[model samples]
Target chain A: MTANARANILSRLRATTTQGSFAVPDAPVIAGLALSLEERIDRLRRMLETMHAEVQVVSSSAWLGALKARLRARGLNGLLYGAETPLGAALEAAWEDDLPPLVPYSESVEQCREQLFHIDAGITTTRGAIAENGALILWPSAAEPRLMSLTPGLHIAVLEAGMIFNTFAEAIDQQAWLQEGMPTNALLISGPSKTADIELTLTFGVHGPKELVVFILT
Target chain B: MTKTADVLAFERNVTKALDDGQLRRNLRSAMTTLSQRRRALFADVEAFEKLRTQGQSIRRRALSRLPELLEQLEARCTANGIQVHWAETTAEANAICLDIIRRHGAQRVIKGKSMVSEEMHLNHFLEEQGIEALETDLGEYIIQLDGETPSHIIVPAIHKNKDQIAHLFHDRIPDAPYTEVVEELNAIARQELREKFRAGEVGVSGVNFAVAETGTLCLVENEGNGRMCTTAPPVHIALMGLEKVVEKLQDVPPLLRLLTGSATGQPITTYFNMITAPRRPGELDGPREVHLVILDNGRSSIYGDPERRATLQCIRCGACLNHCPIYTRLGGHAYGHVYPGPIGSILTPQLEGLDEAGVMASASTFCGACEEVCPVKIPFTEILRMLRNEAYARGESEHDVKGHGYRYTTVEALSWKSWALYNTSPGLARIGSQILGKLGQHLPMIGPLKEWTRTRIPPPFAPKSLHQLAQERGLDDDR
Candidate 1:
């Protein structure tokens, strides 16, 4: 790239950042909004039912182990059990084969970001679900880079038994728990990446991941 | 090159396409896949419809304020240090492009896929002026080498299968062997295009949408060729239709959502580059001089007619093409125009002129499927009907004689009025029907009933009319 070309790109970038032309309408921050864990889980169940997507719930440590075993049986790779396990050891264990390695758990969120750029799939916790648009929101902080959830083709998100909401408005209204500030990144993934550009012929997995798998842990 | 009437030429081409079973199969398979993908992507019915309405209204609003917006866009673009040029026709647009190339002393041009350029036949014109124009997009590069026009809008070389592509590649490349694998063919083309991208002096592309507020041009694509073409050359030129503009930046997201979803059934394309101006002093990878050529070949005239004004809402997603039954059967080449689908059936005639290209208007089943799937919600079937009416008025229709005969016999003559009066009174209508039925049975063939009887037995004239039958059955008289 020429110096002139680099200057042009930087100038355009500066102009855009300073112009504030692409600013979205600022969302209002509300206080004292809360939902019980059971209510959230139930709302999620209803939304999934409407979309004809399946949902599974697991609670016991023994059952979680069995679920991992079953996922392996179904040809899913990089299965790592993170509970009571060192984050580094789990990462190494997940990297056993040619199949995409998965981390079962991370002791620290920072470990997740280090492994994110190379991983093909990520199973992470969702802060909450918005009912209005049927979206699952994930926040990226210093511990977890935004790229981990976005770069992968398959995002297997595990929501706690009670974090789902009925609408996106409700999800936005319920963001009072953060102590420091909003995370640098938030991804609202609704479905898999798809395309129908070729002769209007639909082909999945053009650029983004072809599939999205979400699990609810009771 | 051909001076034949567009409708007559189109009819001949469509007839040939209908006979090619292989082409029909390829189109059908591709269309089916596209329709399924679109269906999956737009599962949220309410949101999808809302977006469609928004897109339609935005385009309509933009067209109403087009002249003003174009002036505004030109001013802002010029202020941003990008040169803007206006062309009233394809000839003018081509001349301006050539003049720019000549001024820069450019010998080689690498082009991204721009349908407006295709409409103007810019490649041929440029080549005539002794400049090499390379199509950098993979699909376009293949068809360029094949020496054929693009068969589809989004995917240019859609009609050709892998085997045919392999054969074409083998013939074109000196050392490359013919291969069926797609990756190998792509690699060969990639290798061939990389040199053009590196060495070309001019880069040309089509603008998906030009933001009037900030004087930004948006190019959305899955392949990286558009980026390469825009950034590789010192001189970058964009040929945009006058209709491809939106008022503000916020309007862009909704339009993008609809365009990407309708075109490829994707939420968004891989690359959505918003280019504001030419490369500034410190930019690493952008053109030094950016030129935007706004072409209004025949669109201004279209905006004047209320019946055809809705045609301007087209985002060129080609969803109507995928769902159109006639288009799937006939393929793009059969349309004998740059656009070749449901939208094409209505738009081509208007832009090219109804007297010459109106036959395409009658090609629809009026199933309303095109309108249903249209991202910008163009009332395609209704526009088609209006075009057909215009065709008939100009005596340009193949069915003109039949249409005229019907109009003369039914509308010009008052015999049908007398017949209607007789039918109004149930007793009189029944008696007349009985007489006509007796005459028909006795004299084997005669009058208006003769031709009707020759094809198949006409409905037997009943002794009792429908009203009497209804009354006898105790149904409501009004019904």
Candidate 2:
């Protein structure tokens, strides 16, 4: 029955001819003009800031301290992240001082569901950044699935400076998004969860992260 | 305006909406503010126009190859481990969704804001089957709590103000716990819906754009409910109209640009989820099973027509609703359906058949603001007129309207015919004017014209005819 319905719809649609001919325009590979990587990163930071996200660039030697200080400032005590991630390895090795519990996403969600509710923050490594829209494209893999970015109250994303692009088109084309095997989920997150539904008040943290803090690797 | 065993009286609906001063005030202020935000975003006039043109062409190109693209979408989505279903009607769609829930032995489902689900009246259907479907979007949640349909697409509860919403929360919940502060009201809903998301067995959402190339379904939202629904639940079910498919992934950005800029004046929504499939092996916390239901309720009939096919190009932005003079005044309830405003004025009649929903064709004043603000540039005013013509043709036969309705009675049509005849011939026009002048009545309480004169004073006839006065002044032009 489902196959029959599908065929019926396709047959009717195939016979359809719209009133006028339309010339299909070529989708430009890059929507905005190219800029130096430094300029692109600055623009990305500025745009993300405009969307109410906190952004900063730090040298490799100073980033871990900066990350810890920023997390403490937000009163975020416990951290949730992917254990096998490079970020995790660096933080583990850098911890000569006392630190909070680092909950690994390697645990299945059901096993960690109760603790996930109380965790102060979750962090993930972004695949790249789209500078024009201040978006972080995270392609969910087996290691870090979607919930790591969404379930927590505060979401902190780390992006390398070299991974920034001028537009989403460039990101897709440069990465060969579809040609390469893609993940089961991906997202273009601009800022924290927000809503203007109630009398047009711009309130954040409605369902997703209340605050989005980004650390750019310089 | 009351629902009575599935009978819809559009006139009564309009009267009820117009009588509520709060509804009028709420819609007026919100629509004005929304359209202003939209206008502010298009400050770059040249770039904005170019983008709209590009958006329209993308939609046209997609529609031009819809069957092929849909086939590609199904195959690619299947390859990505997403189970896709096809339904030819709203009944079939509801049944399929219910079956999926039954398979999991689930009795509770959480829903994101989906106009497709509303069109199927999915909540009511699920209730009958002893399953609870909770609306998670804040605006939709408010309307659902009140047992009402959405009054507007983007802002579903645009008809209610802060006080009313606060009252609703106080009245409906177990205890009247919160004040009417806007942020507090939002917090109340957030606190309530969070537990529903965690406990639900299945999640339902609407697809904004289904990319055929990557088999990715794009869901856009400003709030986190969309994320929670698709991410927290064990099984995810997505509903999309057949026309929502685009051929390539890159075709998305231009449309997304126009949609955000035109709809809510944002660069991009906060969350853009590209779901290629359910949870893969060794992954945590996405739906274990993903199902995509493609609905074809009355869209194929619209596709059968050539010129009317352009109606399918709409991106559901609600810009048309904001700009439409009639819709902004009447509110969405006046349309008496899930869709409202200028798009609804034409779409409902065609979908429900002209005989039943044809009165909507006459709901417009033929203003072009809807087309001017439409992101994809659907010719709404022209379509309204075509539907009116179709309504008149249908109204001519008693059989066509036997179980449905008549937009215009024969008496009204004949009255307009005689009125047109008098205006064309000067001699008859003079006699008719002389009779009205001698009667000393400014407005006539006669026939279908009474419906018009109820709210307006009929203009009195001149003391002398234009032809007569022109000849007396020696200014009559002989053509």
Candidate 3:
């Protein structure tokens, strides 16, 4: 039945007789203008901030201290981190004993579903960022899984300033996404989850993180 | 209006919708806000026009080679370990979904925002088979709780205000309290739907753009429910109309920019997800099995005609709806279809034969607001007018529009034929004008012109025709 359906549908489409090529004169790609790193960061910060996301820049060596202070200030008790990544080890080694507990995502979701949902925040290192739309491109892996940036109330994303790109196409090309084969799940997140479903009134944090705080390591 | 059973229902629904004060207020405010947001975002008119051209080119190029793209998409998806199914009709789509569910022995399914699933009526069908299907999107959840269909495509519950939603949650949700506060209502939905995401055995979602080169399904959503639906469950099923496919990954960015900017004036949605496969060996999360169902459902017939095929280029942005005068006034309910507004005016009839949904074409005033704001620049007024002709042609024309000439009646056809004859012949026209100048004022609402006069006042005729006055004034006449 499915085979016949495919055949019939394709045949009907092939039968269209009118001849006109659907081609447009090529032009420079829109949204592809190059920008300096400083301009990119400024653009990214401005766009995300308008959506209620917090963006802060800190020195590469001192960013963890800033993250700790922000988390402490917010009274977050548990911060979920990738257990297998190098950043996880660094976080573990530099942490003070009195600070919030760092929960390692060592188990499958089935084993830690409750804890995953209840954690104060989940932090992940972003693959790269898009400056044009103020988005973080996340390619989920074994260590920093898909749900680390989702599920929790607060998402703390750490990004290196150099990893930001001017546009989505540039990021895809520079990262060699098509050649490398696309990941199982890739995401471009610009802000905390939101919805305007209720009378077209915007409300934040319907099903994803209520707050998205970014720490750009300069 | 044409004298048909469905036309009467369409008129009645329009009247009923116009009478609803709350619905009118909600639609008016929402349309105003949405259009303003879009306008502000696209303030750079020249740049926006360039991007729109890019978007139009991408969609048209993909559609031109749709069959080949579908084949390539299927092959790449299969290579990535995701199963692909083809369905020619909504019924077949439903059957495929049921088969997948039964194979997994899944009793509970959670669905994200999928208009295609709504087209298939999958929720109601699954319920009859004893499987519980739940909607996880906050707006969809509210309407599902109330046992209602979506009025607007982008915002399903746009017809109801916050107060109405608060009342719905209080009455329907167990142990829920009434609250008009938007945040609290959203929190309630988030808490309720989170539980379903955890317990659901299967997840269902919609595809916004399917990249054929990489076999990737891209979903654009502001809420994370779409992510949860595809990730938290053990199995994920994605549904899309065949027109959603694009030729390459490079085609996505421009289209995405146009869609987001035009939909709600957002530079980008909160989350733009690109899924190429399910969970892999080392992945700690995401669904283990993924399936893609491509539905035809009369799209093949639409694609068979070059002129009508432009209808498939729509990205479902709803920008046209927000800009339409008729849609803003009546809201989405007046049209009474799965899809509504200007896009629906052309789409539903094409999909469901001219006889059944032909009245929708007449709903437009041809003001062209919808065409002006359309991101891809779909010639909406042209298509609407063309559909009206198709309905009246009744299969007499070469085109294969179903139920064509459904509006034709012997009396109406004869009257139009005679009217054409009398006007073309100068001798008969002069006599007709003389009669109208003498007695047109005394003419009553009768025959074909009766419906025309129902909402309109008859014009007072002058004592003489324009030609007679022109000749009396000694204007040059070739004759």
lDDT of 1 by residue, B411-453 (tens): 4247767877896887787777667656745656767668667
Residues B189-246 of candidate 2 have per-residue lDDT tens digits of 8888877877879999999999998899999898989988898888999999999999
What would the per-residue lDDT of candidate 3 be over residues B1-479, giving only the tens digit for each residue? Answer: 23477898898999999999999999999999999999999998999888887888888888888999999999999999899999999999999999999999999999999999998999999999999999998889989999998888888888999999999999999988889999999999988888888777999999999999999999999999999999999899999999999999988988999899999999999999999998998788999999999999999988887888889999999998898888898988789788899999999999988888888888899999988888887889988988888887854654567678888888879989999999899899899999999999998778657978888987899989898999999986676
TM-score, chain A only, candidate 3, equals: 0.93
Candidate 2: DockQ?
0.55
Q: Candidate 1 regions off by >4 Å?
A: A1-218, B1-8, B394-479
Residue B390, model 2: lDDT of: 59
Show how many residue pairs clash in every candidate, following the order shown: 21, 0, 2
Q: What is the C-alpha DockQ of each candidate?
A: 0.04, 0.55, 0.70
> Model 3, which residues run further than 4 Å from truth?
A17-31, A73-77, B1-3, B474-479
Predicted structure 2: lDDT: 0.83
Query: Which ten residues in a row are the worst by lDDT in model 3 chain B?
Result: B394-403
- Backbone clashes in model 1: 21
List the candidates ranked by lDDT, beginning with the highest: 3, 2, 1
